[model samples]
Target: MLPAPSRPPRLRALAVAAAGLVVLTSLTGCTQIASAFNGLQQNAVSTPAPRPAVTQAVSMPYDSKFTYDGSVSLSTDVADGLEVRLDVWAADPKRTQEWAPDNDKTFGFAVNVVDHRVDEKAVLTQKRRVYMSMISITSQVSQSTIGQQQMMSPFQFSADPRTLVPSDTMRSDRGLLLNTFQGGLLVPTTTIHQLPADTYGITLQFALQVWVEGTANTDTSFQQQTVYQVLPIAIFSPTTPTQ
Candidate 1:
């Protein structure tokens, strides 16, 4: 009831202005809050999602045990029943089972020429003959980083095949007769020194120079030719302790 006393006009006006300022401040604060919330929402919508990580595949080393005691048979369309058989194996079977690049390795190979058209019991001169004059082997190693690496042979073997034969047999300038009274050629073993550290596989290429008779009845019509054979051996990496 005491407030019924009339207030001053200027004071009334000042009170009205203060009330309007409070309302304007409240509206401005609310608008700022709303604008901040909308900015956050827009940022969330515009941002890109993270990408996934990439991984590469790894390859395993080759195993030597797979090729031991393997034989390769070769023949040409020019001759029927004339086959050249090659048998290859590790000199030390136990050691080669775990072949490594640092250690020395030896391999053995045998070459046999067979003429199925003639009797097995026939004498050397009477059968279709294949004379082996030269035997050579070249090697290559497969490496992951270097691709293919060429290697030098530890030993060189070049001889007349007939020289290895018995003195009782008749010798000919043509070379050693593979299909003879005896069996085929046998190379006990050829040693290979240490290879590149990263070698995973080894390839041995065998080249044989030979004189093959055109007819089974006579050796006079012999023609010279070269025969090639490839043999692959896997190599293992040196073992290391796991971390």
Candidate 2:
């Protein structure tokens, strides 16, 4: 056969360079695709699962004439080895059912003290005896209007709790002796009058001042302390019927 026409040196060199470029381009494309797939796999393994949403419930006001639970019990162990209990209730359930804004509401309450470290019968004579000195109630309304009056007290109460007890009971400047033979002290009822016409709810805060006996069982080495309790009342709308 006739000698094949020899390709020029320049043309042969160009063909070799183009083949190498094609191979390099193919390898670079495969590398890029592998890198992208690996990134996706890593994200799938490292990502956290989605979480559920959370929500809260809201409290609504009660009807003014509705006869709801009027009693609440509160206890405090703030004093060492002493447990103070407070029981509060509507003075008259019937009256509570008729309660409305711009009217009076009455409440009854009692206070009792117990010593877990000692017997109930001996709490009075024990060194850990608790005595009541003063009791008071302060009020706050949920809502108010211009010129609407606030209530201080429907009737005045003695700042001294001892006055509420019988004279035959143990006498001390510390106040009224609690853990008495009778069990506890009761305030029959107190009225709150002329609430703000726009009030939807009322909160009454009671504060009790007491003296806790120290290490001495016979002598009056007492430390003063206060116990607090709160009561919330929902007022019915004047136009709404009992429901």
Candidate 3:
């Protein structure tokens, strides 16, 4: 085995918030709703028979107005037999659009997602980090345009992993919200003009990329991997208040 780092390698964590806009208009009152698959999960790790391991699925909201809390749980296998567990959610005030002339025509969501990993056999010799690759949105119910963009890139701290001791339990986690805007609001120059007030079915796609340290002792030996997931969101216009 290659020699370990002079000092214990550090753990690296990442968080991302991605936001985009697409116009949708309701056509009919009879809505064909798709039930939110609460706790949607997929296993990409080990396929061994259940001798003592247990599997569980968590549920997330499927239908709601904009700016509400929505969550999706994740558990997947990554490079070097590492298992990752995390959750993804849309930030509160999921969408914001003001009608004031001075107000910027903007809307966004704070979709936070986190990923942590642990090697099954304690074989990790270096740090591990995961990044939010991309978030996509599409509206088939309104016949609108599709929107997708890379959330955030890995940064300096994220490139460095937290130390992992040989005898340590071997676990770490990082958090991020995927959005194009900062402070949960798009920049003044952003072209995302408004949020649709129509009832429609929308699909959101999320992707994650991971980098795992290798025991080869060379920088080139680091392993890189990616994970992808798709989720559904339902939108309904707020009811007008009685005067």
Candidate 4:
């Protein structure tokens, strides 16, 4: 014969146990699926892209040709019997960087009494002649421990800094040494005149000096080359009487 029928209370207890199991599964879903992530992953949400490279501006110790159209009027007898005057013009970015004593000191294109040719006896056949300049290049790089706050390109190359003396530096002897140099340079006004006019096929070769301490680190050098030629002009004869 069969056993007695199950009680209602016994059925109710079985239903409650089944409901508890379902609740436990819902609360701990990760625990059951832990094995699915055995191979782990580690990555940042976002990444920065690499920047493109840039090229720096090349300067002295590497010779380059520049064209000029400057305006000036020279007085024949000035600067201890030399023709001296002023010029207002533009120079090549490369060349201006080469001549400045301190590149940051200025970016102005001005004039000076930079040339002198003696007429001793044989004077030019014309007066008021438009002149061409055969400039010799001098450059040096100064490197002082830049204060952490320093900013901008600190190199200033200029051929005529002595003339730019603010009233303060006018009487200074060491002013040129302190003010007119990268590390140090001695660009006498005569350097421009001494350049060879041997006519390397109608080109005037000027001297270029190697500067150190700025950016061209090693014992750098600038080779001799014809940088520029002047535009020809006819002027009143230098030998003409002062009418």
**TM-score for all models, in order of appearance:** 0.62, 0.61, 0.33, 0.17
Give stretches of model 2 more than 4 Å off: 1-67, 95-97, 144-158, 180-183, 216-221, 239-243
Evaluate model 1: give its lDDT.
0.53
Query: Model 1, range 104-133, lDDT digits (tens) per residue?
Result: 675545566668877866776567777778
lDDT of 2 by residue, 171-221 (tens): 467776665342346554455555545656676677888887765275556
> CA lDDT, every prediction?
0.53, 0.54, 0.27, 0.22
Per-residue lDDT value at 193 in model 2: 57
Highest TM-score scorer: 1
What is the per-residue lDDT of model 4 for residues 1-243, given as tens digits with 9 covering 90 to 100? 112222235223322432232222342332322211111101111122332343232221222222121222222332233332222222222222222222211111212222233332222221111222222323222212222122221111223333322232222222221111111111211211111111011112223121111111122321222222222111111221221
- Candidate 3 per-residue lDDT, tens place, 1-243, comes to 112112111111112221121111121210111011111111112121222233232223334322232334445665554444434334322232112112222222222222233432222232333323222322222212223221121000111111101112122342221111211111111111123333233444445454444432244554556655544444333432111
Model 2: lowest-lDDT 10 consecutive positions = 40-49
1 against 4, candidate with superior lDDT: 1
Query: Which of 2 and 3 is ahead in TM-score?
Result: 2
Worst 10 residues of 3 by lDDT: 29-38
- Clashing pairs for model 2 are 64-236
